[model samples]
Target: MMISSQKVKVDPRDAKLSMAHFYVAFTALALGGLAGLLQVLVRSGKVELPYGIGYYQVLTVHGVLLGLVLTTFFILGFQFAVISRTAGTLSNRARKTGWIGFWIMTIGTAMAAAMILLNEASVLFTFYAPLMAHPIFYTGLTLVVVGSWIAGGAMLTSYIRWRQHNPGKPSPLLSFMVVVNTLMWIVATIGVAATVLLQMLPWSLGLVDTIDVLISRTLFWYFGHPLVYFWLLPAYMCWYAIIPKIIGGKIFSDSLARMSFILFLLFSIPVGFHHQLMEPGIDPAWKFLQVILTFLVVIPSLMTAFSMFGTFEMYGRSQGATGLFGWLKKLPWGDARFVVPFIGMVAFIPAGAGGMVNASHQLNQVVHNTIWVTGHFHLTLATAVILTFFGISYWLVPHLTGRILTKKMNRLAIIQALTWAVGMTFMSGAMHAAGLLGAPRRSSFSTYGESAQAIEWIPYQIAQAVGGTILFIGIILVLYIFINLAFYAPKGEQEFPVGEVTDNAERTPMVFENWKLWIGITVVLILFAYTIPFIDMIQNAPPGSKGYKLW
Candidate 1:
């Protein structure tokens, strides 16, 4: 039987807690966006801030705030809402634990932000070892990770309680996805956790004289690629479980959706070495294996695309539209929530293709550390992930606040999405073009005494600045919409969209729900992928590098 669309109203306390998480997330978005604007302008050689804020500092702020802080807060809050509405109302103890996690994360964010602003932690978000920051910076980030762990624990506890009460029943798909994400996070973070606690934290505190850059980077990318999935899966959750309903259709296949998520859990972490394809310290054989694994992970993304198209086509035909492309016209283009995220998915098409290039050993040589890599991530993380977050915020803020998303605000949100699309197109396109022309990324200035090649980058640089300015304006509009939605909109209960399965007869396989089996396989894949390379690196490692603070 298809699951019903019933949604339990969130408890007022839970709503307040979720709102707190969102408020912090939006604040991070604003600050990071301003930093992004500064970056493009300064790099274009058009404007220079008189303040002590240098390029590296702004870059650090932009990366940490948006990439880490904003995503963490928003994901936690969205999952909380999903669990509360789908699984059951959280226990009082769980609610209390959630609040504690929030405070811990908030305090940690402040500590890290202070260090960055004071120029004590300009190591950048990558924080590649030997380019050290103050000890407090590492400590703060550790706390943030620990805080997320605590929050994940609370989510797990809630799911366990629900499972206990109802034996032999599949968990709600939304809660199931959240739990899977939580476990994936717990497993994936071990890499970065070890890197920080054993390596970076000690080295920063002067307890260690030097650290292995190769090993540290190995650990970072181990967590790093999966971290991209962590940002993505939540948006995918909405796409799989919610978007179909918004467009007047049910999910194409619940089984396929579950399997895709499970596959992601198994494959995401083991392929991190693909990011290091251009690095020499790693063996070529290991890199090739990772490149193969990287391609394997693409399967789930293709599955998602296929399922979404099928669902849209089914709905279109039901509405009497004819022809192969008729579904395109039937989609709810005017709905801010649907349209905004749909745009994000469209952006992912090229982002995913570019990723394959990055993973290719021969092809990566052209783009490594260039503006092309920066553009690729901007398309993936900045466009696909962040734009979906904006779409979620539109409905989510109102849902939590028990307020109506007024027509005027909805129109503004559509405009904001359009503006972002235009802005990112110009900026990221220019970045990719400039990269082909030998433009370096992360440089303070590109013009080196009128070198012709460097001079050729000027127009693209100007285009980037122009795009960034437009994007900043869109950010402001989104913040305004959120503020008004949370505090000033007319009070009303928001409908939580949950897409039902169209084929009720096709039950999800029991194997798809076997958590232990999936986890076991995931661990095995990770071990197989990393064991030899890590051991080889450690045993034959070169002398470690000491800290440097060039910035």
Candidate 2:
């Protein structure tokens, strides 16, 4: 049987704070969605804009605003709500720190966005070395990073204080998972922090004559792959700890769920070098090792899939259904909260398969810089991550605002999710097909002087443009639903759904909460994977290259 919690009234101040973060996140979604629409149009060679807005500029905006700003703000907001509701109210000082972090992030985003808009920082979101952006751009992003650190610090401090008061008890599952994600972020960001503060910022400011490309890229991938996990873990938290409850079931195994999260913390970072399989200057042996580690990280995902399917089977059987796949038919298909994220999980199946292909050294060569890679990540990040975020928003906004989510709004949300799925199916499918034909990514035009191979890609490019337009409309609909829910809906208290463990025969072991042990192992694994390769790169490095403005 499913266990349910009594509705707890959120503190007014905390609700408002979470709402503030959501506002910024949704605003980023709107702006970034527009940029995404324009990008596909321009790349298709079928549209032009006034005011000299180049492809790279729009691309940078799309990546930074959607990839970085939207995800960070949303995660922070969601975690704050989860922590506050589950672990009790934060101290006044902690709340103030959160507000401070918000402002810092906002100011930093504005600074970087201004530079990109002025065409001063057309370097894409990766901002790889030797193609430098303005110093302010790097500085602004630093502030954003630091702001996130401050926010995470506040959350972590609250958890520590809670643990001190409630010794010998398991922390609330949602809060525990939130802290895990925060700690993972703390560990993963060190590489990018080192790269930006020491290398990119200095070089952009002319404090350094040049910067090493290989070293910079290595540092980025060190952080980059974990960044995907950072985006993913929150969604996983919902799936494992909350979604089952929404679907009339409990999580299959709390102990196994905790173990899966712990495994993610241990395996996520050291495997990032898999992104560098095609890059030169990195040792192939090191790359192969990371590839093995990459496959290891997939274990947690498989664990999650197993737990989720088990939960579904139990629920279905409880409802008197029987058969190999009868549980699938018993799920709550009409509930927008369940359906939106359910579709995201379905999309992740293929996305995860694509990741394995990308990690393979031989397979990586075929799709390394191609649109296939673009399609792969679009399915993962855009469809899987973003769709789950939308699902969360549907309920989260209502919960924070004390609004009753009407049936009409829920229906609209379902429509939005379906629209997004349809659009992505068209766009990503075409991207993969065109990429197999040697169509390049990150280009304004792929015609290559209208060569035959390039000519074959045009239809797919046009299809991508059409798909993007549809996806933009879906995003706009989501934003609209959020605004109405937050500002205009009738006031009511919404319960936070925290799933119970189906297995009562066993308790979560104390070792699952031993974060220090996991963190130590994580650091050691990172060192083992990276230490030798980094030493080799720096010791045998060529002279660094000067910055350029090729666009």
Candidate 3:
């Protein structure tokens, strides 16, 4: 049995820690959202960057601040708060550790942002090699990664302490999900951490004249694809555990949710090769193997889809809804908390389709390196993950701030979400259409020597600018709502919704809590997938390439 509460507030101290993370996250959202708008304008050929700013510079800022900074900070903060709600309040030591981690990350973000501002690190989000940035940029990012690890320690400490205190009972669902994501994050980040610390850092500092490009890229995608899941699982947590509660439904199946998370841990890391399907140096056999693993990762996502639909349908039918689609009408459509994330859920259907296209070798060739990939990323992360984050924030921000989400703000949030939906449909749809016509990603306003195909892309680019502008408006609305909630909203008890498992659902097995078993398999799977190919790339590599400062 779970603790049943409609108005459990996170301890005030814990709330402060989580709010600190949110402040940074929203600041990143403001800056990164601005960078994103500018990028679209430049790409559309509507406006040139006025300050001698390179397109890649803005691109890096947008990707790093939004993709890395915003996601990491928000997820950590949300996790801490949720864990405090479910497991218990954090210990004095853990809370202190969280503050320290927050400061380190903030300082690191400042360092990295300063470098990007100075045009010292314009090597976009992937930071793929032969395109080196300042050493300090790498160092700053390293600290950021380290800071996250320390923060994760605080959450993990609480979870472990909970288990120690209560023998043989199932852990809280949200806490369990957080543990799974945090562990996966730790495992997946090792690849990037290795490349950065051992390879990129040494080369960037001029200690090495050349870096092995293949291995560096290999390491990146190794960290890269699972990074997708690292972002997605938190949203999934909301979908699986939190959303059900929000909509007045029990979780469809506690065991099913746990299983999907475990499957993600096992399969997400080995599938990085799908991202590298277009790159050479790896054998076709290994690429094929990893693509197969990529499909395996899809299973969990589908399971989550199945689970979410079931949760909603069950709740609907219980409320007297009938027919195949009646549940759609029964959900709380007016609640921004439900509607906003539901839009994200709908977007994933196509986003998942686009992913399948990207993962398949034959199909990937058509869209590889095209703006279609960019569109796919935006749909999945920017729309699906981000919109879900926004939905969570509506309740979460105020829930922490000791304030109620007023109806006026709730209506505004719904409008904000709709604006995002419309904007993304235009922007991403145009990118996909243009990409199929051979519009390249990561390039700014090229006419390609007046080629016909190139000219065709210009219209789609303009559409993206239109869409980007709308999305920026959505950002502003969200920030406005955030500010009111944090400082001025009326004081009240706001619930932190955690779903109860359906009565018919079977008990969650304690085996899921056996970290040694799950983690051991995770390690084995990663080793099995990467060991041979990584060695092959390193052993039979081409001459290393020297760094370039093209920007």
Candidate 4:
């Protein structure tokens, strides 16, 4: 007897389920944003949440939910959009699995967030031992990460299967980036899974006497650093693939896009110790090596920035606009896709670049565990990533729903993007100042004490508080626009405008498929991995020595 097999085709434009997926991601993001608001407010003493747990729990939940869960779902949906067209019969299953993963991940993250907010598990989000939380929180988070892992699996399988059937045709640049992202996810999470399932879980269950705080942190950051790239890649992919089209130009160099993706895959993981710059027991040499790779990775990132911006210049010229960046005005500012990425770039450059400075071994000591660090991350991840997701949704959902947004709503989105960008900048600036003034992070309020004025963090704290209010208003506006788009936009009148399709879909041949790209990526990762044992050396050294081992 023979079994019958059938092929199924899913419409990429069938965004009804896509919209549901995005909403789940969006709602989680909004909750995280709310948590951020509360954190800032509570830290500034503007209001007390009355939770028994310290503010660190609130900050951790906000970071994990928004940065990890929301981003994972958003990336999953975005990846589907990029790959579905070329994925043949398996696209339907991929899309279905994507939505399933979204729901599971959202529910898990929500459960974890509720636990955090309810003051049940206040242990900070790190993998360090002796600071355990309620099992429910860890279990919820485990499910959330597991859901993302499944989504990554679906993406890899679908892309690989597509390539197998098609033969000799290279994967799309966007699809290749997704593959790299999936690879990084698998590699990074090994530590998290080992710690959570083997160490943390066992410890929480009283099966272990003590957990190795040093090894756990090492593993967590091993996951944490590259995990950042995972959040940023979709935005960067848009920067590479979608931005050029938005500007009505071909990408400056397709090779550059691929190069950047591969670089992220290789170097992104090894830089985890940069987060441990202030920690004990890590080898100085390994930290130094990571610092070097961290700096090296910046080159590809800057290449992306230049190429994407170059397209913007070309776009302006195409529109008959003149002068440097003058053509920005020629583009439709009301389009959320365009507006969000623009804001993302403007916020990312300074914040992300400054992050490299902090990533340096010595400089990290200066700003270690400071508010400045928080400000820097908020700039790239919170401000940039969230905006990109909103922008992509604006372009995608209308096409999916077959609805045209009201002209007013479009303009409001632009306003929302602008407001968010500006608000984040203001707050982030204050945080930098506060950090310099010795205002440490993970605290409910500035502990500058009676000499607060002397410490000079008070003024900056005031600025952060005010900036938080502005950010909250801007976020509310954004949520309102999306809600209206989903619920209020009349189904009959809603249609994605025509010109926008051709605006970004036209692609030139990608040049990054050759051996050169692989070699470059391999070299970077090899260099990164070579430095790992060095960190262990530092952990074994005597006190005050360069390689002192402190766990």
Q: What does the lDDT read for residue 90 in candidate 1? A: 90
lDDT of 4: 0.70
Q: Write down the lDDT of every candidate, Cα atoms only.
A: 0.88, 0.87, 0.91, 0.70
Q: lDDT tens digits, residues 108-156, model 2?
A: 9999999999999989879886678998998898898888999999899
Tens-place lDDT digits, model 3, residues 213-292: 77888889989998999999999999999899889999999999999999999999998888888777789999999999
Q: Indicate the TM-score of model 2.
A: 0.97
- Cα lDDT for residue 523, candidate 4: 53
The C-alpha RMSD in Å for every predicted model, in order, reads 1.9, 2.1, 1.8, 5.6
- In model 4, the runs with Cα more than 4 Å from the true position are 1-17, 51-54, 86-92, 321-329, 446-449, 453-455, 492-551
Model 1 over residues 1-551: C-alpha lDDT tens digits? 23455455767788888889999999999999999999999988888866777789999999999999999999999999888877888999999999999999899999999999999999887988777899889889988999899999989999898888877777788888999899998898899989999999988888978887888888999999999999999999988988888888989988888989998998899998888886767898999998898899899999999988888899999988898798789888899989999999999999999998888888888888889989998999999988898888888888889887888998999999999999999999999989888788787563464678668899999999998999999899989999999999999877777778886527777676677899999989999999999899878777535223211
Provide the lDDT at 166 for model 2: 83
| Cα distance off (Å), candidate 2, residue 447 | 5.8
TM-score of 1: 0.97
TM-score for candidate 3 = 0.98
What's the lDDT for residue 41 in model 4? 84
Q: For each of the candidates, give the backbone clash count.
A: 0, 0, 0, 12
lDDT of 2: 0.87
TM-score of each: 0.97, 0.97, 0.98, 0.87
Off by over 4 Å in 1: 1-3, 446-449, 544-551
Ranking by lDDT: 3, 1, 2, 4
Better of 2 and 4 by lDDT: 2
Quote model 4's TM-score.
0.87
